[model samples]
Target: MRPLSTATLLCMSLIVPSLSQAEPRPANMVYLRTVDPTIEQDIRYATAHNFTGHPLDGYEAPQCLLSLDAAQALARVQASLKAQGYGLKVFDCYRPARAVADMGRFATQPGDPRKAEFYPRVDKQDFWHLGYVAKVSNHSRGNTVDLTLIGPQGLPADTWSPAASQADCAAPYGQRWHDGAVDMGTGFDCFDERAHTDSQAITATAQQNRERLTEALKKEGFVGYSKEWWHFTYAGDGAQKAVMDFPITAP
Candidate 1:
Protein backbone atom coordinates (compact mmCIF):
# COMPACT_ATOMS: atom_id res chain seq x y z
CA MET A 1 0.00 0.00 0.00
CA ARG A 2 3.01 2.24 -0.02
CA PRO A 3 3.10 4.97 -2.65
CA LEU A 4 5.75 5.10 -5.35
CA SER A 5 8.89 6.91 -4.27
CA THR A 6 9.67 10.33 -5.68
CA ALA A 7 12.60 8.86 -7.62
CA THR A 8 10.35 6.22 -9.20
CA LEU A 9 7.74 8.86 -9.99
CA LEU A 10 10.39 10.99 -11.70
CA CYS A 11 11.54 7.99 -13.72
CA MET A 12 7.96 7.23 -14.70
CA SER A 13 7.56 10.79 -15.98
CA LEU A 14 10.40 10.18 -18.41
CA ILE A 15 8.71 7.08 -19.88
CA VAL A 16 5.95 9.05 -21.53
CA PRO A 17 6.98 12.62 -22.17
CA SER A 18 4.19 13.34 -24.63
CA LEU A 19 0.97 12.19 -23.01
CA SER A 20 -0.84 14.98 -24.86
CA GLN A 21 0.29 13.74 -28.25
CA ALA A 22 -2.03 11.60 -30.32
CA GLU A 23 0.59 8.97 -31.02
CA PRO A 24 2.97 7.49 -28.46
CA ARG A 25 6.62 8.39 -28.65
CA PRO A 26 8.70 5.21 -28.60
CA ALA A 27 11.77 7.04 -27.36
CA ASN A 28 9.97 7.77 -24.16
CA MET A 29 10.12 4.09 -23.21
CA VAL A 30 12.53 3.55 -20.34
CA TYR A 31 14.48 0.49 -19.24
CA LEU A 32 12.99 -1.13 -16.13
CA ARG A 33 16.42 -1.51 -14.59
CA THR A 34 16.74 2.26 -14.57
CA VAL A 35 13.62 2.54 -12.44
CA ASP A 36 14.35 -0.42 -10.16
CA PRO A 37 17.62 -2.27 -10.55
CA THR A 38 16.85 -4.71 -7.79
CA ILE A 39 14.23 -6.56 -9.84
CA GLU A 40 15.41 -9.62 -11.81
CA GLN A 41 15.00 -9.78 -15.58
CA ASP A 42 15.32 -12.62 -18.08
CA ILE A 43 14.28 -11.22 -21.43
CA ARG A 44 13.82 -14.36 -23.52
CA TYR A 45 13.45 -12.87 -27.00
CA ALA A 46 16.96 -11.50 -26.88
CA THR A 47 18.30 -15.05 -27.09
CA ALA A 48 17.57 -18.28 -28.94
CA HIS A 49 16.15 -20.07 -25.92
CA ASN A 50 12.52 -19.12 -26.54
CA PHE A 51 9.77 -20.93 -28.43
CA THR A 52 11.01 -19.45 -31.68
CA GLY A 53 14.24 -21.47 -31.33
CA HIS A 54 16.02 -18.37 -32.56
CA PRO A 55 16.33 -14.74 -31.60
CA LEU A 56 13.53 -12.57 -32.88
CA ASP A 57 14.02 -9.19 -34.45
CA GLY A 58 14.22 -5.90 -32.51
CA TYR A 59 15.66 -7.52 -29.43
CA GLU A 60 19.19 -6.23 -29.58
CA ALA A 61 19.89 -7.13 -25.99
CA PRO A 62 18.33 -8.76 -22.96
CA GLN A 63 16.47 -5.93 -21.31
CA CYS A 64 13.12 -5.21 -19.73
CA LEU A 65 11.66 -1.98 -21.06
CA LEU A 66 8.37 -0.52 -19.91
CA SER A 67 6.33 2.63 -19.85
CA LEU A 68 7.09 4.84 -16.88
CA ASP A 69 3.80 4.15 -15.18
CA ALA A 70 4.06 0.43 -15.73
CA ALA A 71 7.59 0.31 -14.39
CA GLN A 72 6.57 2.31 -11.33
CA ALA A 73 3.69 -0.04 -10.69
CA LEU A 74 5.84 -3.14 -11.16
CA ALA A 75 8.43 -1.75 -8.77
CA ARG A 76 5.72 -1.51 -6.18
CA VAL A 77 4.64 -5.07 -6.92
CA GLN A 78 8.22 -6.25 -6.48
CA ALA A 79 8.51 -4.50 -3.10
CA SER A 80 5.26 -5.99 -1.87
CA LEU A 81 6.24 -9.51 -2.93
CA LYS A 82 9.73 -9.13 -1.46
CA ALA A 83 8.19 -8.38 1.94
CA GLN A 84 6.33 -11.71 1.65
CA GLY A 85 9.54 -13.67 0.98
CA TYR A 86 8.85 -13.79 -2.76
CA GLY A 87 10.04 -11.60 -5.61
CA LEU A 88 9.34 -10.98 -9.29
CA LYS A 89 11.39 -12.32 -12.19
CA VAL A 90 10.43 -10.86 -15.51
CA PHE A 91 10.57 -12.88 -18.76
CA ASP A 92 9.51 -10.27 -21.25
CA CYS A 93 8.37 -6.65 -21.15
CA TYR A 94 7.51 -3.88 -23.60
CA ARG A 95 7.96 -6.07 -26.68
CA PRO A 96 8.80 -4.26 -29.89
CA ALA A 97 6.13 -4.33 -32.60
CA ARG A 98 8.67 -5.76 -35.00
CA ALA A 99 9.24 -8.72 -32.69
CA VAL A 100 5.53 -9.40 -32.53
CA ALA A 101 5.45 -9.23 -36.31
CA ASP A 102 8.34 -11.63 -36.38
CA MET A 103 6.36 -14.06 -34.27
CA GLY A 104 3.52 -13.86 -36.73
CA ARG A 105 5.90 -14.48 -39.57
CA PHE A 106 7.41 -17.43 -37.78
CA ALA A 107 3.98 -18.87 -37.38
CA THR A 108 3.43 -18.99 -41.12
CA GLN A 109 6.77 -20.49 -42.20
CA PRO A 110 8.12 -22.91 -39.66
CA GLY A 111 9.16 -26.43 -39.02
CA ASP A 112 8.94 -27.52 -35.42
CA PRO A 113 12.48 -27.71 -34.24
CA ARG A 114 11.28 -26.59 -30.81
CA LYS A 115 7.83 -28.09 -31.11
CA ALA A 116 8.65 -30.91 -28.73
CA GLU A 117 9.63 -28.36 -26.13
CA PHE A 118 7.17 -25.48 -26.64
CA TYR A 119 4.01 -26.57 -28.45
CA PRO A 120 4.10 -30.31 -29.02
CA ARG A 121 0.36 -30.77 -29.41
CA VAL A 122 -0.13 -27.65 -31.53
CA ASP A 123 0.75 -26.98 -35.12
CA LYS A 124 2.89 -24.04 -36.09
CA GLN A 125 0.30 -22.63 -38.49
CA ASP A 126 -2.37 -22.88 -35.81
CA PHE A 127 -0.61 -20.51 -33.44
CA TRP A 128 -2.58 -17.48 -34.58
CA HIS A 129 -5.83 -19.42 -34.77
CA LEU A 130 -5.35 -20.75 -31.26
CA GLY A 131 -4.52 -17.28 -29.88
CA TYR A 132 -1.06 -18.45 -28.95
CA VAL A 133 0.36 -15.59 -30.96
CA ALA A 134 -1.12 -12.12 -31.28
CA LYS A 135 -0.89 -9.89 -34.34
CA VAL A 136 -0.86 -6.96 -31.99
CA SER A 137 0.41 -7.69 -28.50
CA ASN A 138 -0.26 -5.68 -25.37
CA HIS A 139 3.46 -5.85 -24.78
CA SER A 140 4.02 -3.51 -27.73
CA ARG A 141 2.08 -0.93 -25.73
CA GLY A 142 4.75 -1.14 -22.99
CA ASN A 143 2.44 -2.01 -20.09
CA THR A 144 2.39 -5.80 -20.22
CA VAL A 145 4.92 -8.23 -18.73
CA ASP A 146 5.56 -12.00 -18.66
CA LEU A 147 6.84 -12.85 -15.21
CA THR A 148 7.02 -15.36 -12.34
CA LEU A 149 7.79 -15.41 -8.66
CA ILE A 150 11.14 -16.13 -7.02
CA GLY A 151 10.86 -17.97 -3.72
CA PRO A 152 12.57 -17.19 -0.44
CA GLN A 153 15.70 -18.89 -1.81
CA GLY A 154 15.92 -16.08 -4.38
CA LEU A 155 15.18 -18.30 -7.39
CA PRO A 156 12.40 -20.18 -9.09
CA ALA A 157 11.44 -23.52 -7.57
CA ASP A 158 12.11 -25.34 -10.81
CA THR A 159 15.28 -25.09 -12.83
CA TRP A 160 15.77 -25.93 -16.48
CA SER A 161 17.37 -29.36 -16.71
CA PRO A 162 18.32 -30.45 -20.18
CA ALA A 163 18.04 -34.05 -19.11
CA ALA A 164 14.34 -33.81 -18.25
CA SER A 165 11.82 -35.33 -20.63
CA GLN A 166 9.81 -32.94 -22.83
CA ALA A 167 6.18 -33.40 -21.90
CA ASP A 168 2.96 -31.45 -22.18
CA CYS A 169 2.75 -28.26 -20.18
CA ALA A 170 0.26 -29.78 -17.77
CA ALA A 171 2.54 -32.73 -17.16
CA PRO A 172 3.94 -33.36 -13.72
CA TYR A 173 7.19 -31.91 -12.44
CA GLY A 174 10.33 -33.19 -14.24
CA GLN A 175 8.15 -33.91 -17.29
CA ARG A 176 7.46 -30.30 -18.36
CA TRP A 177 9.78 -27.57 -19.51
CA HIS A 178 12.17 -26.87 -16.68
CA ASP A 179 12.40 -23.09 -16.75
CA GLY A 180 13.31 -22.75 -13.07
CA ALA A 181 10.31 -20.56 -12.45
CA VAL A 182 7.94 -21.25 -9.59
CA ASP A 183 5.73 -24.16 -10.68
CA MET A 184 2.65 -22.55 -12.19
CA GLY A 185 1.27 -25.65 -13.97
CA THR A 186 3.10 -24.75 -17.16
CA GLY A 187 6.17 -22.85 -18.20
CA PHE A 188 6.02 -19.28 -19.43
CA ASP A 189 4.33 -19.05 -22.86
CA CYS A 190 3.50 -22.76 -22.74
CA PHE A 191 0.64 -22.24 -25.26
CA ASP A 192 -1.55 -24.77 -23.52
CA GLU A 193 -4.88 -24.80 -21.72
CA ARG A 194 -3.04 -25.85 -18.58
CA ALA A 195 -1.41 -22.45 -18.64
CA HIS A 196 -4.82 -20.88 -18.11
CA THR A 197 -4.96 -18.89 -14.89
CA ASP A 198 -7.78 -20.92 -13.41
CA SER A 199 -7.21 -24.33 -14.91
CA GLN A 200 -8.11 -27.07 -12.44
CA ALA A 201 -6.02 -29.82 -14.02
CA ILE A 202 -2.77 -28.78 -12.43
CA THR A 203 -1.79 -29.80 -8.91
CA ALA A 204 -2.95 -27.76 -5.95
CA THR A 205 0.58 -26.53 -5.39
CA ALA A 206 0.83 -25.04 -8.89
CA GLN A 207 -2.55 -23.40 -8.40
CA GLN A 208 -1.40 -21.86 -5.15
CA ASN A 209 1.78 -20.57 -6.76
CA ARG A 210 -0.21 -19.05 -9.59
CA GLU A 211 -2.58 -17.38 -7.17
CA ARG A 212 0.30 -16.06 -5.15
CA LEU A 213 1.79 -14.46 -8.24
CA THR A 214 -1.61 -13.07 -9.20
CA GLU A 215 -2.27 -11.53 -5.78
CA ALA A 216 1.10 -9.83 -5.63
CA LEU A 217 0.73 -8.33 -9.08
CA LYS A 218 -2.92 -7.44 -8.50
CA LYS A 219 -1.94 -5.48 -5.43
CA GLU A 220 -0.23 -3.01 -7.76
CA GLY A 221 -3.11 -2.85 -10.26
CA PHE A 222 -1.59 -5.36 -12.71
CA VAL A 223 -4.20 -7.59 -14.31
CA GLY A 224 -3.34 -11.21 -15.12
CA TYR A 225 -4.09 -12.68 -18.52
CA SER A 226 -6.66 -15.43 -18.17
CA LYS A 227 -4.90 -17.54 -20.78
CA GLU A 228 -1.35 -17.06 -19.60
CA TRP A 229 -0.66 -17.11 -15.88
CA TRP A 230 2.73 -15.43 -16.29
CA HIS A 231 1.38 -12.52 -18.27
CA PHE A 232 0.05 -9.34 -16.65
CA THR A 233 -0.76 -5.83 -17.77
CA TYR A 234 -0.83 -2.50 -16.01
CA ALA A 235 -4.05 -0.90 -17.18
CA GLY A 236 -2.82 2.65 -16.98
CA ASP A 237 -2.54 5.40 -19.58
CA GLY A 238 0.30 3.36 -21.07
CA ALA A 239 -2.27 0.78 -22.10
CA GLN A 240 -3.61 3.25 -24.61
CA LYS A 241 -0.22 4.28 -25.91
CA ALA A 242 0.64 3.46 -29.50
CA VAL A 243 2.49 0.21 -30.08
CA MET A 244 6.23 0.55 -30.46
CA ASP A 245 8.89 -1.04 -32.72
CA PHE A 246 12.01 -0.07 -30.87
CA PRO A 247 14.62 -2.69 -30.00
CA ILE A 248 15.07 -3.65 -26.36
CA THR A 249 18.59 -2.62 -25.44
CA ALA A 250 20.41 -1.43 -22.38
CA PRO A 251 19.69 2.25 -21.75
Candidate 2:
Protein backbone atom coordinates (compact mmCIF):
# COMPACT_ATOMS: atom_id res chain seq x y z
CA MET A 1 0.00 0.00 0.00
CA ARG A 2 1.10 3.56 -0.63
CA PRO A 3 2.25 5.61 2.38
CA LEU A 4 -0.39 7.89 3.92
CA SER A 5 -0.04 11.60 3.21
CA THR A 6 1.47 13.79 5.96
CA ALA A 7 -1.80 15.72 6.37
CA THR A 8 -3.68 12.43 6.77
CA LEU A 9 -1.15 11.21 9.31
CA LEU A 10 -1.48 14.45 11.27
CA CYS A 11 -5.25 14.15 11.24
CA MET A 12 -5.06 10.56 12.43
CA SER A 13 -2.78 11.74 15.24
CA LEU A 14 -5.65 13.82 16.57
CA ILE A 15 -7.42 10.60 17.47
CA VAL A 16 -6.98 10.20 21.23
CA PRO A 17 -5.97 6.89 22.77
CA SER A 18 -7.88 5.13 25.56
CA LEU A 19 -6.75 5.75 29.16
CA SER A 20 -6.19 3.22 32.08
CA GLN A 21 -2.71 2.18 30.94
CA ALA A 22 0.40 1.67 33.11
CA GLU A 23 1.88 4.87 31.60
CA PRO A 24 -0.38 7.42 29.92
CA ARG A 25 0.29 10.44 27.68
CA PRO A 26 3.23 11.54 25.51
CA ALA A 27 6.75 12.33 26.79
CA ASN A 28 6.34 15.84 25.39
CA MET A 29 3.69 16.34 28.07
CA VAL A 30 4.82 18.43 31.06
CA TYR A 31 4.97 17.27 34.68
CA LEU A 32 6.23 19.11 37.75
CA ARG A 33 7.09 17.05 40.80
CA THR A 34 5.21 17.93 44.01
CA VAL A 35 7.54 20.11 46.05
CA ASP A 36 5.29 22.39 48.00
CA PRO A 37 5.09 21.40 51.69
CA THR A 38 1.62 22.86 52.20
CA ILE A 39 0.41 20.86 49.19
CA GLU A 40 1.85 17.80 50.91
CA GLN A 41 0.03 18.59 54.15
CA ASP A 42 -3.29 18.96 52.36
CA ILE A 43 -3.02 15.60 50.52
CA ARG A 44 -1.96 13.89 53.74
CA TYR A 45 -5.12 15.18 55.36
CA ALA A 46 -7.33 13.79 52.57
CA THR A 47 -5.49 10.45 52.66
CA ALA A 48 -6.16 10.30 56.39
CA HIS A 49 -9.83 10.79 55.62
CA ASN A 50 -11.84 9.45 52.66
CA PHE A 51 -12.68 12.90 51.24
CA THR A 52 -12.15 13.28 47.45
CA GLY A 53 -9.86 10.35 47.92
CA HIS A 54 -7.90 8.09 45.56
CA PRO A 55 -8.02 4.37 46.21
CA LEU A 56 -4.74 2.92 47.57
CA ASP A 57 -4.19 0.73 44.49
CA GLY A 58 -3.60 3.73 42.20
CA TYR A 59 -1.07 5.46 44.53
CA GLU A 60 2.14 4.67 42.62
CA ALA A 61 1.11 6.69 39.59
CA PRO A 62 3.20 9.84 39.41
CA GLN A 63 1.09 12.92 40.05
CA CYS A 64 1.99 14.58 36.75
CA LEU A 65 0.95 17.19 34.16
CA LEU A 66 0.33 16.50 30.48
CA SER A 67 3.51 18.38 29.69
CA LEU A 68 6.70 18.48 31.78
CA ASP A 69 7.06 22.18 30.89
CA ALA A 70 3.77 22.93 32.58
CA ALA A 71 4.92 20.91 35.55
CA GLN A 72 8.08 22.97 36.07
CA ALA A 73 6.23 26.23 35.67
CA LEU A 74 3.61 25.21 38.22
CA ALA A 75 6.33 24.00 40.56
CA ARG A 76 7.97 27.41 40.45
CA VAL A 77 4.69 29.06 41.25
CA GLN A 78 4.19 26.76 44.25
CA ALA A 79 7.76 27.35 45.37
CA SER A 80 7.32 31.12 45.36
CA LEU A 81 4.42 30.71 47.81
CA LYS A 82 6.42 28.47 50.12
CA ALA A 83 7.70 31.43 52.21
CA GLN A 84 4.03 32.12 53.04
CA GLY A 85 3.67 28.43 54.00
CA TYR A 86 0.92 27.41 51.54
CA GLY A 87 1.35 25.09 48.56
CA LEU A 88 -0.64 23.12 45.98
CA LYS A 89 -1.67 19.50 46.53
CA VAL A 90 -2.91 17.69 43.43
CA PHE A 91 -5.89 15.34 43.71
CA ASP A 92 -5.48 14.00 40.15
CA CYS A 93 -3.32 14.56 37.14
CA TYR A 94 -2.99 13.05 33.60
CA ARG A 95 -6.12 10.92 33.89
CA PRO A 96 -6.29 7.72 31.81
CA ALA A 97 -9.26 7.41 29.41
CA ARG A 98 -10.12 4.04 30.93
CA ALA A 99 -10.42 5.75 34.33
CA VAL A 100 -12.87 8.21 32.82
CA ALA A 101 -14.93 5.22 31.72
CA ASP A 102 -14.72 3.85 35.23
CA MET A 103 -16.16 7.10 36.53
CA GLY A 104 -19.01 6.93 34.02
CA ARG A 105 -19.84 3.36 34.96
CA PHE A 106 -19.57 4.19 38.65
CA ALA A 107 -21.71 7.27 38.16
CA THR A 108 -24.56 5.06 37.00
CA GLN A 109 -24.58 3.46 40.47
CA PRO A 110 -22.59 5.85 42.60
CA GLY A 111 -23.36 4.16 45.90
CA ASP A 112 -21.38 1.00 45.10
CA PRO A 113 -18.61 0.11 47.62
CA ARG A 114 -15.88 1.60 45.42
CA LYS A 115 -18.13 4.58 44.92
CA ALA A 116 -19.39 4.69 48.50
CA GLU A 117 -16.03 5.42 50.11
CA PHE A 118 -15.33 8.39 47.83
CA TYR A 119 -18.91 9.60 47.53
CA PRO A 120 -20.93 7.93 50.25
CA ARG A 121 -23.72 10.48 50.05
CA VAL A 122 -24.51 9.97 46.36
CA ASP A 123 -27.37 7.68 45.26
CA LYS A 124 -25.21 5.99 42.52
CA GLN A 125 -27.96 5.65 39.88
CA ASP A 126 -28.31 9.39 39.17
CA PHE A 127 -24.88 10.13 37.68
CA TRP A 128 -26.01 10.06 34.06
CA HIS A 129 -29.13 12.04 34.94
CA LEU A 130 -26.77 14.54 36.51
CA GLY A 131 -24.36 16.69 34.43
CA TYR A 132 -21.33 15.11 36.13
CA VAL A 133 -20.52 13.00 33.07
CA ALA A 134 -21.17 12.99 29.36
CA LYS A 135 -19.96 10.41 26.83
CA VAL A 136 -16.92 12.69 26.67
CA SER A 137 -15.38 14.65 29.57
CA ASN A 138 -12.98 17.58 29.56
CA HIS A 139 -11.06 15.80 32.31
CA SER A 140 -10.06 13.30 29.65
CA ARG A 141 -8.29 16.34 28.24
CA GLY A 142 -5.80 15.92 31.14
CA ASN A 143 -5.83 19.53 32.35
CA THR A 144 -8.73 19.20 34.74
CA VAL A 145 -8.51 17.97 38.34
CA ASP A 146 -10.79 17.26 41.34
CA LEU A 147 -8.77 18.64 44.25
CA THR A 148 -8.83 21.28 47.04
CA LEU A 149 -6.45 23.33 49.20
CA ILE A 150 -4.97 22.34 52.57
CA GLY A 151 -4.47 24.25 55.78
CA PRO A 152 -1.05 25.01 57.28
CA GLN A 153 -1.51 21.95 59.45
CA GLY A 154 -2.67 19.78 56.50
CA LEU A 155 -6.18 18.42 56.02
CA PRO A 156 -8.97 20.21 54.20
CA ALA A 157 -9.94 22.97 56.61
CA ASP A 158 -13.01 23.29 54.41
CA THR A 159 -13.28 21.02 51.39
CA TRP A 160 -16.25 20.48 49.12
CA SER A 161 -17.99 17.31 50.16
CA PRO A 162 -19.76 15.43 47.33
CA ALA A 163 -23.52 15.55 46.80
CA ALA A 164 -25.44 12.74 45.06
CA SER A 165 -26.16 14.99 42.10
CA GLN A 166 -25.20 18.28 40.50
CA ALA A 167 -28.50 19.63 41.82
CA ASP A 168 -26.82 19.55 45.22
CA CYS A 169 -24.47 22.29 44.02
CA ALA A 170 -26.91 24.64 45.66
CA ALA A 171 -28.31 24.49 49.27
CA PRO A 172 -25.45 26.17 51.11
CA TYR A 173 -21.75 26.25 51.75
CA GLY A 174 -22.41 22.49 52.02
CA GLN A 175 -18.87 21.47 52.87
CA ARG A 176 -16.55 24.35 53.80
CA TRP A 177 -13.90 26.19 51.81
CA HIS A 178 -12.67 28.30 54.68
CA ASP A 179 -10.06 27.93 57.45
CA GLY A 180 -7.18 29.88 55.82
CA ALA A 181 -7.73 29.05 52.15
CA VAL A 182 -9.67 31.35 49.83
CA ASP A 183 -13.43 30.92 50.19
CA MET A 184 -15.39 30.10 47.04
CA GLY A 185 -18.84 29.82 48.67
CA THR A 186 -19.10 26.12 47.87
CA GLY A 187 -16.48 23.41 48.28
CA PHE A 188 -14.64 21.78 45.33
CA ASP A 189 -17.44 19.47 44.09
CA CYS A 190 -20.48 21.59 44.95
CA PHE A 191 -22.18 20.61 41.60
CA ASP A 192 -24.73 23.45 41.49
CA GLU A 193 -25.31 27.05 40.49
CA ARG A 194 -24.64 28.43 43.98
CA ALA A 195 -21.20 26.87 43.59
CA HIS A 196 -20.46 29.20 40.67
CA THR A 197 -17.37 31.34 41.03
CA ASP A 198 -19.56 34.43 40.70
CA SER A 199 -22.63 33.17 42.54
CA GLN A 200 -24.43 35.99 44.38
CA ALA A 201 -25.74 33.59 47.01
CA ILE A 202 -22.26 33.12 48.48
CA THR A 203 -20.78 34.95 51.46
CA ALA A 204 -18.68 38.08 51.05
CA THR A 205 -15.71 36.19 52.49
CA ALA A 206 -16.26 33.34 50.05
CA GLN A 207 -16.56 35.66 47.08
CA GLN A 208 -13.47 37.56 48.08
CA ASN A 209 -11.46 34.42 48.59
CA ARG A 210 -12.66 33.00 45.31
CA GLU A 211 -11.54 36.11 43.53
CA ARG A 212 -8.15 35.93 45.18
CA LEU A 213 -7.61 32.34 44.12
CA THR A 214 -8.84 33.10 40.64
CA GLU A 215 -6.41 35.96 40.29
CA ALA A 216 -3.53 33.87 41.57
CA LEU A 217 -4.35 31.03 39.21
CA LYS A 218 -4.58 33.43 36.28
CA LYS A 219 -1.16 34.81 37.12
CA GLU A 220 0.20 31.30 36.86
CA GLY A 221 -1.51 30.53 33.50
CA PHE A 222 -4.68 28.92 34.82
CA VAL A 223 -8.34 29.92 34.54
CA GLY A 224 -11.33 29.01 36.71
CA TYR A 225 -14.25 26.96 35.34
CA SER A 226 -16.77 29.56 36.67
CA LYS A 227 -19.40 26.92 37.38
CA GLU A 228 -17.28 25.12 39.99
CA TRP A 229 -15.20 27.10 42.46
CA TRP A 230 -12.46 24.50 42.78
CA HIS A 231 -12.12 23.84 39.07
CA PHE A 232 -9.60 25.60 36.83
CA THR A 233 -7.26 25.03 33.88
CA TYR A 234 -4.08 26.31 32.29
CA ALA A 235 -6.41 27.48 29.48
CA GLY A 236 -6.00 26.76 25.76
CA ASP A 237 -4.17 23.53 26.52
CA GLY A 238 -6.52 20.75 27.71
CA ALA A 239 -7.91 19.63 24.33
CA GLN A 240 -4.58 18.16 23.35
CA LYS A 241 -4.79 15.45 26.03
CA ALA A 242 -8.34 14.11 25.83
CA VAL A 243 -8.51 10.28 25.92
CA MET A 244 -11.30 7.76 26.52
CA ASP A 245 -11.11 4.96 29.15
CA PHE A 246 -11.94 4.05 32.75
CA PRO A 247 -9.51 5.06 35.54
CA ILE A 248 -8.81 1.93 37.56
CA THR A 249 -6.21 -0.65 38.69
CA ALA A 250 -3.84 -1.62 35.86
CA PRO A 251 -1.29 -4.44 35.82
Model 2 misplaced stretches (Cα beyond 4 Å):
1-25, 29-31, 34-38, 41-65, 79-86, 110-130, 150-182, 236-239, 242-251
lDDT of 1 by residue, 1-251 (tens): 99999999989878866536424346557888999998888787887667787788988889998888889899998888878887888999988888999999889884665676677777888888777899999999889999988774333345444334355656675566556566778877787788889999888988888888898888777898887889999986555467777666666
Candidate number achieving the greatest lDDT relative to the actual structure: 1
TM-score of each: 0.83, 0.59
After superposing candidate 1 on the true structure, give the runs of residues whose Cα lies further than 4 Å from its correct spot. Answer: 1-27, 153-168, 237-240
Q: CA lDDT of each candidate?
A: 0.79, 0.49
- The true-structure Cα RMSD of candidate 1 reads 11.9
Cand. 2 Cα-lDDT: 0.49
Task: Show the lowest summed lDDT stretch of 10 residues, model 1.
Answer: 153-162
